[model samples]
Target: MLEVAVIVLAVFSVLLAAACGWLILSQRHLAALQAERDAVRDQRLKELSKRLDTYLTGSVRMGEELYELRRVVAPLPDKLTQIEQRDPSSLSFTQAARLAGMGASVDDLTQSCGLSKAEAELVSKLHHAQHPTS
Candidate 1:
């Protein structure tokens, strides 16, 4: 009976040792898997951070460009108003010149734009000189 009991005890010891070794191996594998997962997570975070930084930089640059454009364009309305308020005689001359360019006769320029005959003739000559017969 004692011999049978000793054999049973030896079998149990061997089984326990095998179970302990398996547990140790499983623990090492789990640790390696966890390390790999952590590395992948860190890499993803770095990529996301870079993309966010790039987006922010571009947004800031666009904002600056818009501000500059607004500053440059702010006085355009006043300048246009000044141009619109210039001398009425100058406007008439400009009309005469445009009419002459469009192939209107000197008499037409004098009648339509209220220019003198000499001014209409000069404008017609200037237009003809600048744009000769094609």
Candidate 2:
């Protein structure tokens, strides 16, 4: 009986040691996998930062071009007014309306074309008074 008890105790000790060794190996593998994942994440973040910098540089260049165009065309409105003053009779009704600042004018012949209903009514009244149907 004593010999049987000693053999059983030895078998239990061997199983406990094997279980501890397997647990330690599994923990080491898990740590290695986590380290590799962190490295990949850092590399992706650097690439995204570079791409954003490029887009911001392009946006600034486009804004400068737009400002330059606006400066170039700054004198156009005055030049157009001078030409109209020199030859007012040759200007169309819509052009006259815009110059007079009256929302409705005689030259707007097309119905519902750009002008609102009130504008059209004003234009109709002016047309009738200038050339009565009777």
Top model by TM-score, which number? 1
| Clash number by candidate, in order | 0, 1
For model 2, the superposed segments whose C-alpha errors exceed 4 Å read: 1-7, 86-134
Worst 10 residues of 2 by lDDT: 103-112
- Tens digits of per-residue lDDT for model 1 on 1-134? 99999999999999999999999999999999999999999999999999999999999999999898667656644543353356643687678767877889999988997867876776676666556691
Whole-model alpha-carbon lDDT for candidate 2: 0.60
lDDT of 2 at 19: 89
lDDT of 1: 0.79
Whole-model Cα lDDT per candidate?
A: 0.79, 0.60
lDDT of 2 by residue, 1-134 (tens): 99999999988899989989999999999999999999999999999999999999999999998788667555545544554466566544344344334444434533434434454444454444334451
Candidate 1: list runs displaced more than 4 Å. 87-134
Residue 11 CA displacement from its true place in model 2, Å:
3.1
